[model samples]
Target: MIPNLDVDLLKTFLAIADTGNFTRAAEEVHKTQSAVSMQMKRLEELVGRPLFTRDGRQSRFTADGERLIEYARRIVNLNDEAVAAFTKPELTGTLRFGTPDDYADRFLPEILARFSRTHPLVTVNVDCAMSPVLYERSRHGELDLALVTACSEIIADEIVRTENLVWVTSQRHSAHMLDTLPVALSHTGCEWRALAVGALERQGRKYRIAYSSPNSNAVNAAVLAGLAVGAIPEICLRPGMRLLSEKDGFPKLSQFRIGIVHRPGRRSSAAEALSRHISESISNMPRQLMAAE
Candidate 1:
């Protein structure tokens, strides 16, 4: 007989995948580290495949482990949806939600769609702007919840994900080969812009800001048009774009953090429900992006 996958074990597995460490995953799932290890052992026994391989102190997912992530997420989400449908009261109200344009493009569709299916009466008012602007709006209580990129100027209530920032150029263009690199970036005060310029300067590579915009789409447009190289999170990478590496004389850029911040004081049921959906949606994002690549 085929063994049934355990929802509790899958939740633990997802916590490990999301945190990238068993110790941290244990903390996340509110279990002892030893118990987490035992759970994984049982999981591997059930699947009859090794899920993780250790590299010194680090734990990396085996191929089968990576493949299981998508399935696990779907199962867990469906389980939650079923439970909420019967156990929780339906939420209704308008929710003021804010996020940067890039995140809105990449994540909001799935998040909002899933949310609406569960809480059809909750209307979400979305505001797209730079992260800094969103942070301020959330702080002022003008927004019920905001997803903001972490930077020196703002604090996030919870960091949902983190990924490497990469330098990219149009696949058909030689923009990265230019002596004075033409670059497209976000406007002043943007953390990505600062990181990009700082990386170039640290490498003693001369570059000029050929395009600057507050909107991510504008920067992406310049990049896709082959007008300039752009620095963006790996998840934001689009087709027809090639990454510039150290071999291309580009310095490695730091990882950026994505976080959720809430307005101070009591939040509406709609806001709380939406926030849970956002977190779960983002938790599965990196695995989906990796699978696509």
Candidate 2:
């Protein structure tokens, strides 16, 4: 036996099956009730079967309709899956994601957690390093996507999130000591380090690196010990640390424009979902992040 059926008819049938009411199914499909009734009649005539038993405006699928609903769901899902696999972009291989040091702690878990929930089958490989290092790697295709600093070069096709840079010193330290270099920072390639150093250079203020480490926690620890003034995200400053504001001639660390970057091509559903989650999470950062100084 041959069945002549259109995809739209099947979609209508599915909607009717789920909603269990002609009026509701018509609304679900954005069709007028009369139009839906006509289509259902046409579909039933073509299949030589009464798909639903109707009592006034209410309807219930017949035994054959129950069997057909399962097949319809499979057929529709498979058709969509096939189109996505071939016509759309297929992204099933291992996805390498790069991220800077502190963001891994601050953001990756939420991003990856949602990503894994959505795409449980895809493998996510995270490469965490300093920002400049990851940016270079992403440029070379070593990583498919990265959380990177948004300098002019990478601004296009980037997802930008703004954060302020503040000087954090141990609460025990006197505010006057800020004149001296109080904290060490990451090595030469770090974005925060560049901002901090550049601001000092512009101010013509002489300062020394009290302690330098690639690890942000290490820098925080140094500041906690009153070894030096560490520049940190206003969000990340520990409770015991004092964030110096403009009254202190605030060494003017520029704001960080951070975002995700990828190669110039279509992204996988998994990657797109991850990127969206990251954008949402960062944009809607907790009030703690922008708390008043």
C-alpha lDDT score of every prediction, in listed order: 0.90, 0.73
Q: What are the TM-scores, per candidate, against the unseen true structure?
A: 0.85, 0.63
Cα-based lDDT at residue 201, candidate 1: 92
Best by lDDT: 1
**Candidate 1 off by > 4 Å:** 1-4, 15-62, 287-293
lDDT of 2: 0.73
Question: Taking the tens digit of each residue's C-alpha lDDT, what string does model 2 give over 49-118?
Answer: 8888876756777888776776665466445445544554334657888886677777777667655554
Q: Which lDDT tens digits does candidate 1 get at residues 1-293?
A: 99999999999999998888999999999999999999999999999999999899888999999998888988999898878877888988899999998888889888998898888888999999899999999999999999999977989998888878999999998999999999999999898999999989998998999999998989999999999999998888888889989998899999889999999999788888888899889966654464214
For candidate 2, the TM-score is 0.63
How many clashes does each candidate structure show, in the order listed? 0, 5
Best by TM-score: 1
Q: Which stretches of candidate 2 lie over 4 Å from their true place?
A: 1-93, 175-179, 289-293
